[model samples]
Target: MSAMTSAKELGPVRSLVPARLDRLPWTRFHWLVVVGLGVSWVLDGLEIQIVSQAGYQSTLGLSAAQVGAVGSVYLAGEVVGALFFGRITDRLGRRKLFIVTLGVYLVASGIGGLSFSLWFLLIFRFIAGMGIGGEYTAINSAIDELIPSRYRGRVDIAVNGTYWGGAAFGAAANLYLLSDHVPVDLGWRIGFFIGPVIGLIIIFLRRTIPESPRWLMTHGREEEAERTVTAIEQRAEAQGVKLTPVPESKALEVTPVVSVSYLRMAKVFFGDYPSRSFLGFSMMVTQAFLYNAIFFTYALVLQHFYGVPKAHTSYYFFPFALGNLLGPLLIGHLFDTIGRRKMILFTYGVSGVLLLGSAALFHAGLLNATTQTALWCVIFFLASAGASSAYLTVSEIFPLELRGQAISFFFAISQGAGGVVAPWLFGRLIGSGTDKTPLTWGYVIGAVIMIAGGLIAWFFGVDAERKSLEDIARPLSAVARGVPGEQSGPSEVTS
Candidate 1:
């Protein structure tokens, strides 16, 4: 271990690491950090799409029910992994957990490719889900902490949105990989390997990225945190970006407790910041319902209402995906420039309104398959960015000590409640009846739910744009908070 500053040497003094890190200009090092860690989402999307598409093949000789069971197993694994590993991330460090999780994913996914039977595949796939689920908590915490405040919003939103890009790529890849010329058994196995191959290359990139300096400070390694920030500064200066010194007044004094109890976290979450907790839960669950309900049942809607051929569903899907991907890429900066509350409200409210209109058009027998697809593309373009911001909201609103576990708690709740329920409810809505009334009513309910999320953001949202994490929500261990307008301690926190 590196030498650390002694608390006794300068009693009650503030550490400059967080301020220094937040004030630095963007550099090559920052980009490397983004790319290296951000690829986790891509790999996750690729792994999921490949399995969903190829799992039901006749070559596997599995019944449809058995294939569906595989998906449930993966989802259950993800929820378990997030809750279990998210706590580990808070106790251990981000760098260690992120690297370990990726290794687990690579090995488990690779082993999954070698599976010859349902039991074999189930075991490895569950392990792989655990890895990706762990990555969510670790990576999001690291990204928000390490990136400069000004760039954090857009970067985080864009990175989360890249999952769609991977899905699109997977969709295209399967078109060729699953073609009749390829044997079904061989093709499905190869599809599983795609993520592992990509992951191996990304592991090398992760090697170069440094541990978050903010995390170091809270762990009582103030000297090491200073050194890490200094190295980052030296690199930025070398890249021709002039570095400005952050004043000592910007520094924060914190009490370094090695661990926080779940009981304390619950108090902080529900008792101390009840409103913010509700806001996070509302955002997560609503987006999960809207996205999962629409995404999982979209093809069935197309086939039933538009009389569209099953074979042509993928072609329609490409445009919807392109809209989703482009939303964050195009509008992400607004989350920083315009501020979080406004952007969140706009994206969520507008998408909900648009969905209402789309629902009406469909009910009226006005939209054909082509127009309906186009309409969905426009609505989801806004919805995707809002959904991505829902993640950003939960990740940022909590104290640094609880960020990982907070993410895990909300993710598990949203996935368990909304994720599990949405598909089943939507499937029932799209029952064997030829009439589209039930599904249309489902759309109206989805719209209402989204609008409710928007209203919650309007009332309870934190305007976290372009502010340090400490500025948004003080670290649980922090002793002397620095934000000018904000109060320092948990008791004094604003709603």
Candidate 2:
């Protein structure tokens, strides 16, 4: 579909770059962007999965409380990394930050493999979390900017959902790493290196992916943006995809600024788009709480409540991870087709309702480990797509100027508020011996939070499907002087 918009306020020279990029057919270039960027989530899943399982192993010698602290500390690092690098991503450009953040992860993960004590492990885990956190902001912004709007929803959801692919791989790796087949002390160290090993290979692939043209134009680099888009078009044509010419009328005229202060960005988000701010918060926090509560503590629940051996926990996790991976792969297209609001509401509502029902069965003591794992598979099958969409929502709904920062802001908030607390609380509950009552209530609470998020989406969600980012949320710098009834405000930044 053509992303042609009537000329609004004309204050400066405009380029049809966004519409041009969005109207292109899918090609090898698009796949390169998807694979190169999406692998960060998989690496994150592997890192978290390895730590979640290994912390319980005898060789690691971590107490239950200490293990929970590991999750909390890692989340803390994510919050810091997002805020710090997120700003840099906006200022310095996506390509630079993507390279830097991945380098940080590689070095940190390799060093983590050498940890002999809890504090040593904790420090590196935090550093690694920072890398993944920065990756979330930089990569999401790049993917959304680079991919055509028509394919954005499924691609984003599928890419985000690949985190579970790493989780499943981590779970499978733990089967051997935690087994008597390998030395207990050395196996855990090997687990830590898995992400870095895979990441080292992917770093080169990422180097081939270009910086965002939208970001380039917003930073007043029109020539570079043109070159980048030309290269992309050349790649598409080389791959035999017919290219459509972008119309001149689609160009947006604006004054591009070098920098926008965080304070002003905050005002733009909260002061002008309060409902969106709230919606982003609601989606992020609910998913963060539910995921951190269950995933980080799944091994403990199995060992305590179900009497599953530490070595066998990964077996349960693999199936659980598979369900999560499959969710977005199966239903992700609906976000673009059935529409964001309906699909998000459906996925969240169904997951929450199923979780509540599962909590009741868990309280009744009717579920064995197998049944419990099966139930989790069913619940998260719906939940994973919804969770992935939270990232999608934040990335797509905001203006390009603050896209990276907005992602970082909501990510930090969700992790700080929900991710940090859930693991510690759940860990304590699991540490309370064989009782399942506390954990049951935790599940119920998580369910309610998810349902509330769905309700918020139904009310406040933006209908951004198949729309250009500029159309969804007009660029901050876009002037609207001549258009009838169009008024420019402090928040309406010209880009």
Candidate 3:
């Protein structure tokens, strides 16, 4: 091993890496980070929208049950991937895992396009889901660590929201490819390659981005951490952006550990930081349930309830997706300015209340298909921003060492608890296409779930806006050191 690797294995070290990173002004380098890291969500959304299309059943000679199983299988892969790779990301470092994960998706999805059998396609779909799931943990950790604190909230929210853009793109692509314009066999196969083609371009761009310096500092590679920050500073100066100095008081003291045991992770999550744990789980589960329940069943509701034709349903998705896309773009800055706690509450609360009102109208037989779609657009305009913030909340609140694993765990749990159940339950409620009463109650349940999430956030949420990640949660590796006016020892739980 080299001397630098040896030093990382030694012991405690102190560095200003986080402070140095947070003090820099925004520049092209930051934009590169945003585009490179943020595209993961877009890829995920594309994969989902493509797989959900019905062309697959006719092309693969599959039953309706088998087609539904394919979607479930992919979701199962995401859960497994997040848990397995999340731990690897914490141990192996952010940049390595991100590159490997994206490559996994590229190869798996590309080969999946050529699949001739149901078994073959299912296997690759599972593998591709793993790649995207791992991307969630690795990319979120890297982005939060690399971006400046002041810009972090809006940037993360906006990036998470871009999933809708990819969804919108896939919906638009299906309009051409799935229609009679292309051969059915060729069109469905081409749909599978869309995300991989996009992934190829993003992988090249990701080559220019660096590993998280915060990850380096905590691992005892102080010299390398310093060098990385210096290079970033040089890039900012090259862009003619003046840089500010980071204060010595902003430096952190850390005792390096090669790895944190899962036991320790469990204790820290449930014991040391209980309220923050509650906050993260509540935020993630509520949004996952609401989004999955409504979005997955959207086409059914339109076709069954409103007597709309199945073929025209894809056209309605554009406006629905546009609202979701615009939400974070317009309202994301408030999370940074109005602050995380208040904005999360507002987004969740208003969206929930609006959903309840819409449910009442549907039950009373007052809404047409067009009016119903419009109401959904307005409601999710706010809910999409709130859902994106759920990811942001989980990513930012935990200690740096466990950041990736923390995200994976919550994502996995939420997927199991909310993502899996919501669709099945709602499908049952929308049964036989006759009664609006059951689905109306379903909407009320969804509304109640979201309102409860907002209330939980109001009571337990962290005031993380404008604060450095280290300030939000001290690393387990961090050593208590007395700064002149700052409180000594580990950071107190903000919730």
Candidate 4:
């Protein structure tokens, strides 16, 4: 036998996994890491939640232009972080990137908490985006490995659900942290600080999170993978739990021989996989556009049209925030049960129709405060659910080698096309800028665009519900019109 195989044989069961996590909800090592990463996503969500509030804008003395710019600047940085760092994760490994990104987030958020100028906030916001961008590629991949394949879809949904929770968490924190004790022009700064602090705390906790064993196996590190799995098993055992399936088996195999030669991500990324790329990118764009159009503009809506008192405007958001948090949870079940194509299409279609209908109510002066808020609530909540799950679908439909790069590509490209633009357009329409439109038409425009996104998804997107990522994305070596793919196991490509 070759020295390499001989070396591998010396390692304890370095072949594969059903990773018995010792009869727990999560595999022994996974529970804490997933929880930590979820908290990261939540903090990410919370920061965004604070952006659109009147309290935020008023404190910063921001024009509509500035608000849009902040979102745009942040997204622009996200693009850099996502594209530059995502593929690097394959080379440098997941744990290193996770820790680095967390650091960036903490520093950005720390300075943002003390910002005196809007421009400084924008700069800090951009840095925060870098952290967020880096988090997705590393953390999601980390989560993918820690959990069993069966739990992927649900965990994917669950991870994203934290963003919704973050929204509420941020809003609530703002209500408490900023309550009665106003920061003279520092309310939003203080709001932005919360996430960074939490991210810093998690960094130390995240240190305990291991590198992906799957990744290690592929990289020709059998000893490391075996050692890592053993550590995980031992940890779980100490917790009075034994890994179910005993963590390793002879039946499963890791025959990968990846090297620098395998680094041509372009072929894997740019080949017939265009359909997957398109699906992923389109999902992010559509979701980002739909979300920012409303979320980043919500406070403006209340202040402009509803005639709600300024001091109490944050209170009005409690129900909406709660619904936003729950929307994904309520609707995410549909993804697994109903199938990807159907759930996304159905939710987006309904959300579009609702957005248009709500706009009509506002435009016609036909909506009373009660009716208006209720409709907005329903529409935004539904939109949030569908939009929230967009990343989950995108992330799951790519192969392991390129998954991080693929998601990062989408996050960057789509945000440029849509996400960063939505708020500016809304601001312009609302005349928050020097020239604004009536609030009524803003809703109409958002509704129309969303409907278009839904139709596009229904027509072109592939179904990912029952199939594993590899299976659904198979024949991805070539892109097609997305002709219905067969729901089969991932074509075993010997890596």
Q: Residue 404, candidate 2: how far off, in angstroms?
A: 0.9
Local lDDT at 364 for model 4: 66
TM agreement with the true structure for every prediction: 0.95, 0.92, 0.97, 0.80
Number of clashes found in candidate 1: 0
- Model 4 agreement with the true structure over 350-454: per-residue lDDT tens digits: 888988777776676777656766776787667776775677766666666566776787777777867767877776677642222365577676677677767
Q: Report the C-alpha lDDT of model 2 over 42-84, residue by residue, as the tens digit.
A: 9988887788775344666777678768777787888889988
Scored against the true structure, residue 455 in model 4 reaches a CA lDDT of 71
Per-prediction CA RMSD (Å): 3.2, 4.7, 2.6, 6.3
RMSD of model 4, in Å?
Answer: 6.3
RMSD of 2: 4.7
Clashes of 3: 0
lDDT of 3 by residue, 237-349 (tens): 99888877777787888766557888878988998888888989999999999999999999999999999898999989999999999999999999999999899999999
lDDT by residue (288-384, candidate 1, tens digit) is 9999898877888888777888767877888988999999999999999998888999999999999999989888899998999899899999999
Give the best candidate by lDDT: 3
Model 1 clash pairs are none
Clashing pairs in 3: none
